[model samples]
Target: MIRVAVVDDEPVVRTGLRVILGSAQDITVVADCAGVGAVEAVRDGRVDVLLLDIRMPVVDGPAVLRQVAALPRPPAVAMLTTFDAREHVDEALRLGAAGFLMKNTAPEQLIDAVRALAAGRRVLAPEAVGQVIDGYLLSGRDEDAVRRVRALTDRERQVLALVGAGLSNRAIAGRLHLAHGTVKDHVSAVLAKLGGLNRVQAAVVADRANMVGTGPGRR
Candidate 1:
């Protein structure tokens, strides 16, 4: 089972998440806490993933993420935010958050997101993907970032396009009819190529180039 910790200031939010995740067969809520309780809970346990809120008293999500990063076996974190603020999302990423998700996400989507993060995959709300891209562009499209993207191979580019198109690794593997391990290799290559801080950045680049879809929209 994927061990999880739910950290948010609101008791209702924590309770709601527990209810949603409790229904999933593959997940277990190892702990649930608000504010300082969250930090203490995580420090004392072996959490595989953390569902974290961006705003909390005593200690906020971002601060919690920072502290988690310092842990010997840091769990992957999915930041839960009320808004799509670029600054908060960017800071979370810089602090090593695996992804940023909206708290109002659909029940099924939230469950799927936890599973994704638990399985070592990045999961961001659809709307937040655009913010990461737009923010990068508005920040002057950093030259190094462009160079990193340019380094991808043709096959790696194909894989990345599918990823940016919002296809999962398994889906991409099916599309390519390649082994899942091959797909994983290609994804790692793509990330290296884009110097992408994570899969989200690579997707942002794919979305920016209009290589996939009508473009990023609400998730």
Candidate 2:
């Protein structure tokens, strides 16, 4: 089973996530608590994925993330965020948070994201990502971003495009009719070729290159 820990200031949000994640047979909410309780939650069990509230009131999420960073083995962390927390989320990303999940994410999508995170894939919310890099890509269009995208193979480009569209590795695997492992390999290659820290950066390059819908979005 994929062990998960939830750290959010709101009790209701934690309970709701527990219920949603509970429905999935392979996932278990091993620890659920507020930001102050984060360290214990992660230490109490082997957490494969951690869902943290990005803007918690008292014990802020970024502060807690630093605590996790000090751990010998930190779990894959995905921030629970709303659209307005883009800057905070970006900072969290730099600190090694693995992905993002909108607070209003659908139940099935939440489950899928958690699974993807556990499998070592980023679970980014594309809509929020588009907002984060708003005008920045325009300046890099002809420079770094364009040159990086040019180096990808056709298959890797297809994978990068799907990734740009926020599809997970499994989804990309299905879309491209390749095995899941193959898709993971392609995603890793794309990150390396693009000189990206994570899939989200590679995604930014894909968007600037106007490649988001070019591959799998085609009929």
Candidate 3:
């Protein structure tokens, strides 16, 4: 089972999410709280994922995420946002959010997203994915980044392709039939070769190079 925590300033939103997620047999809403302090409730352990709202009354989702990131075992974050806010979506991704979901997402999609996250995969709403990719591709000065990305080993290239496709480290390990530690080493090497600060940056380079053909939706 996947343990989930919901953090939203609005009581209605929190209750709605709890209701929607409670219907999924594989997921349990372990805790639901308002404001940033709720993040601490799941910090020690037990929570597997966090459904976070971008704008809260006192402490926002990003602020909570900053705290979560500092924890020893941070739960994967899926920012709950409306589709119109493209800037927030991009910032959330850069801030280490695992994925983004529209607030109006269907119940089934929400369930699927939680499952995908549990399986170490990213889940972006289809429209949001297209928007993100469009912006990412159009962002300037790709030639240098592509050149650096080309320096990776065959295996590292494969790993990087998976990263660009939005597969997490564990998912990459499964696809490559490699131990998690080996995959980590390869990812580190790829990051070093490409001079990427994080997996997201490496993914941007990979996407620009068209190295990862299929995206996060594929297995």
Candidate 4:
């Protein structure tokens, strides 16, 4: 089962998420707490995925995310918010958040996101992905980013583009007609070449550099 922790200042939001995620057979709500309690919850290391609220009192989501990132084995985090703001999305991704979901997300999608994060895949809501891409474009760092991306070989560039599209290694392998191990190697090479900390960062680089085609969805 995928162990999940929910962190939000609102009791109602925490309870709602617990009930919704608890109903999924593959997911268990292992912990539900407010912002202050989040630090301890993640430190226990039982959580595989953490659903963190962005606007909590005192601590807030980004702060909690930083704490999680510092853990010995941090759980995959998904920032939860009421709306998709560029700053929130950028901050979350920069802090190693594996996904971004609006509080209004459907129950099934929320559950799937938790599962995806647990599986070492990313899960960005369509709108959130768009915002991240838009933020990248508006940052005006495309020339520098593209210069870094161009350091990659052609095959690595192809893998980077698909990674930018949020495709998992297995999916990228299937799409590129390559072995899973080969895809993994290429991804590592891409990350090294782009100086990215993770797949999400590599994806951001590809998007910012306009190395990949951009659109509405994770395709």
Candidate achieving the largest lDDT:
2
**Which has the greatest TM-score?**
1
Candidate 4 lDDT over 1-219, as tens digits, reads 999999999999999999999899989998999999998997978889999987776888888999899999899998886644565555666788887787888988888788889998777775456666654555555456568876788888888888887777888888888999999999988787666556666777777667566422344
- Across 1-219, the per-residue lDDT of candidate 3 in tens digits comes to 999999888889889999999998889999999765676778787899988887676887777887887788888888887644444545565578877777778899889889987776566664345545544455445567689876777888888888877677787888878899998899889888876546656776777778776533354
Better of 1 and 2 by TM-score: 1
Ranking by TM-score: 1, 2, 4, 3
Clashing pairs for predicted structure model 1, backbone only:
none
* Better by lDDT, candidate 2 or 1: 2
Error of 1 at 192 (Å): 1.1
Give per-candidate clash totals. Answer: 0, 0, 0, 0
- List candidate 3 stretches off by more than 4 Å: 130-147, 152-193, 196-203, 206-219
Q: What is the TM-score of each candidate against the true structure?
A: 0.86, 0.84, 0.67, 0.83
lDDT of 1 by residue, 50-149 (tens): 9998777688877888888888788889988775455555567668788767878898998888889888898878856766665556556545765665
Q: Which candidate, 1 or 4, would have the higher lDDT against the true structure?
A: 4
State the local distance difference test value for candidate 2: 0.81
Worst 10 residues of 3 by lDDT: 126-135
Error of 4 at 174 (Å): 1.6
Clashing pairs in 4: none
**Model 2 error, position 106 (Å):** 0.6
lDDT of predicted model 4 = 0.79
Task: Assess each prediction's global lDDT (C-alpha) against the native.
Answer: 0.78, 0.81, 0.76, 0.79
Which clashing pairs does model 2 show? Answer: none
